[model samples]
Target: MNLHGWIIYNGNLPGNKFLDFAQWIQAAATRKNSTTTIYKNNELLSYLGIGQLEVLRQDKNKLPDYVVFADKDIYLAKQLEYLGVPVFNSAEAIDISDDKIATYQRLAVKNLPIPRTIIAPKIFVSGQLDKTTVQLAMESLGFPMIIKESFGSFGEQVYLIYTEEELYKMVESLQGKAFMFQEFISSSYGNDLRLQVVGDEVVAAMKRSASDDFRANVTAGGTMTAYKPTQQEEKLAIAATQAIGADFAGIDLLFGPNNSPIVCEINSNAHIRNMFDCTNINVADYIIGYILNRLN
Candidate 1:
């Protein structure tokens, strides 16, 4: 059957990165004898009326057979699903993957290996944290730990706190934000693995490192090298993807004391351009092929 798809991405985000991803998917789908149109999340409006739910696009009213959701706009993704259009990675997967606290909770329930983490209590108004609570969290995770906001990307919202003053200051600055405290993986400092998994297979893998920064995100000035994942590494990456119910994902694995794999983070809408550059593999081909097969 000839397939049609929509590659949806965030339009408001600066730079061409998001649109670039959509175009890549569109090109891949076309190569596979399928047709796809790129749409920005803002271009499609979701409406609610008495006993009706609808999404209307300014240029087109036709919905595709499937949607390659490359945005973190969970509500729009869910709206598409509610309209009975199949969405890759699913809305729930994106929601869970977008929130670190939720992602870790799901992984922990599945017995996946992750860094020791403590979710900060939610505060509506910006304010200071309780001294006793901060003290207990510090005692449990120790100094020189990691502080990560729940909703972040490109390693932008992650921090390393050394002294109590630094920790408190960082926490205070993040007042009213959903964040977490984590045990820093000293063994994997400035290094981690990015394994792209599609349909239970590791299509491509790369090791990311940074000399000047602790975060291994390439967008954060890190470097990437093609990697051959170990059996355990591959297994864990795939398992972590499944744990979040994602059809595909980029799973970041940290090195444990003995080089054991520990999931650092999972990206449901992970960018594949870097993987292609490092591994010379177009993961888009694997992703398009997987979607076609599933639809067939």
Candidate 2:
């Protein structure tokens, strides 16, 4: 495959993890005989006008056949798409995956198994929180529920509220930000399944458990173990990936009643390093292969 591609990640984030993702994808592309260039999101200036769309990239390095978008910069990704470059996972997928409210809405529209959720209305300031909304969610989800901001990663913005006061405080504090109230799945306390799906198949998976936290994200001090997903798990994960219109994704599943699988979340740009460390599976290879095949 003599394909040329670009791997783009966020440059402002103060971590090598984003670069690691871009580099991993680059190496995988290289092994397949594809040439790739890694660029930060800030490197390319997206310009838009009436009947015009272009990025102020260097004239020497032309755009590639495709782009491996590893950042949450949906606007930049959409600009690339507008210029007719096929972007794996696509901008729309990333946009939906980045918003928990949108993710749940997509999942619910598919009639997928998700925890009962109520979206908090977005208010402009800190003091404008509607207690009626809180009352409704409290009545619906009950105590010890979960409150998650619509846009957060690694379990940092998720809260487990055991009382109405904490719930109100948390919800009010997230002014101007989208968030939701969810019924906590007690059966899956401290643990969940992360299935890496490439295209239409589940390629790798691991069980993540935290000793002291409700979230099972690896970035939140969660431990991992290789997991063999049940047929139900694989099917649900694949359906979720498709539901979000992603070429590939990492689907988090919570164990529901009687060990049933519930959709916890879907990560469009999920880092593969942790999954690889746990399962020794290089999901980048699968992603590159999938993109090449799609391009072909």
Candidate 3:
């Protein structure tokens, strides 16, 4: 039971899946005489059998030297922190970065330029809905604004409201969840930069083209092409990662009306698979190595 490293990857393994990553790490550690353990939530439950209280009673305190939580389960990472397990990016960082509003707030406080934004109440369901409120928000923030759910990913819960009617409809539709409305930054190039940063280093970068549709996420049918960040843009990305204490992040920057760079969002568990072929850097390996070195 001498485990070398532990991987907290999501999904089941060894059943239409593989432990090759853990195996590779184990091999890396074997030179120092150790093995690796792959801990998926499914596999953990299967091995532990019944309940959490029962499992906790067993006192399996001999955890691996380093544990990398690959998934975006913020709560699980925080729980591991209580167990003194070194986690990548820290649970708090993940929690903060998960919220678009909170992440933007943190960046703004750090003097980072973000799109002029404001959060709007999601409730306007009844009679005499506050038209004045919506009107003021649009006027103060300006029109052609973008509304977003505080915790959505991949352009899923984001919308653009160019008119008061669209804004009202969006507010009525998302009546229970918190939303943010931000001034739309017009990048004449019709693209935004997705900068992948690790430990103050801008490792991989890409240019995402929004098909006249406006949402810059690929899920919204936006195209992603290889991009190289200018030194200033790289500085902005690094500063943003540091602002949120994120060990790994995807800092989304868009060009404003004068080519001014404005941060639109930050993703904690940024998917690197899309950027792999475009950059010379192996982001996954770099992330794995960075976490192992820092947390170990």
Candidate 4:
């Protein structure tokens, strides 16, 4: 029997990147002799009324065997899963990966080597941060630390603080937002590794570097190159993915003082275009193949 799949992406998001990801997966599925349909998260409405839980689209009766969730719409993803549809990188994994603090907590519990991190206190009202909490964070992480919002992508909400003043200003600007303070990994200031892990294997890897910025995010002006990660790096990347219960993930690794691998972050729906451009490897192929094997 031929498998049928649904690739869901966020329609509200600007730009074609999200749609592009869905297309890639659809193409891969087609190559594997499976049929796939692409849908926007908004296109599928989740209705919750009393004892009814229904996800409705144009054809409510036409449900796929599995879903390739390429968006961070946790509710929609969860709804599909509740309907007995297998969602790649399950809703639970997407939830953990979507929140930086939650991801860190999960990794920490698993004893993964993540950078030293301290969750910012939740502030009900917006204003200056508590002096005592600020002092404690500074004392623990020191200057030139990293401040990153809990829910962000493309490295847009990440800030590098060089002094107390900078930290205070950044925190003030981010008041009423969930974020964390992390120790700066000087050894990997402008460079990091992106290892694409699918099912227990590292499918593609790349090194991203930015000379003028502390962030190595390719979307933040960083350049990418094909890379060969060490066994330790590969193992850590895979472990980090599994820590969040992700079937596949793009795991970013920072270099420690002694060149050891440190988990920076994991992207459950990591964009594969950059990796393809760098390594000429289509991660979609691996993703589709993994899903096929699991289903079979």
TM-score for each candidate, following the candidate numbering: 0.98, 0.97, 0.82, 0.98
lDDT for 218 (candidate 1): 98
Scored against the true structure, residue 2 in model 1 reaches a CA lDDT of 96
Q: Write model 3 residue lDDT over 200-245, tens digit each, in one string.
A: 7888999888767777777577888888788988999999999988
Candidate 3 Cα misplacement greater than 4 A, ranges: 1-3, 10-36, 42-61, 122-129, 188-190
In terms of lDDT, which candidate is stronger, 1 or 3? Answer: 1
The list of candidate 1 runs beyond 4 A from truth reads none
**Candidate 1 lowest-lDDT run of ten:** 54-63
Residue 230 lDDT, candidate 3, scale 0-100? 89
Residue 7 in model 4: shift from native, Å? Answer: 0.1
Model 3 residue pairs with clashes = 4-35
lDDT of 2 by residue, 223-273 (tens): 999999999999999999999999999999999999999999999999999
126-242 per-residue lDDT for model 1 (tens digits): 767888879988999997899999999999899999999999889899999999999999999999999999989999999999998889999999999999999999999999999
- The lDDT of each candidate is 0.94, 0.93, 0.72, 0.93
Best by lDDT: 1
Residue 268, model 2, lDDT: 98
Model 4 backbone overlap count:
0
lDDT, candidate 4, 1-296, per-residue tens: 79999999999989999999999999999999999989999989988989988887887657899999999999999998988999998999999999999999999999989899999999876866798988999999998899999999987888889999988888888889999999999999999999999999999999999999988999999999999999999999999999999999999999998999999989999999999999999999999999999999
The local distance difference test score of model 3 is 0.72
Which residue pairs clash within candidate 2? Answer: none
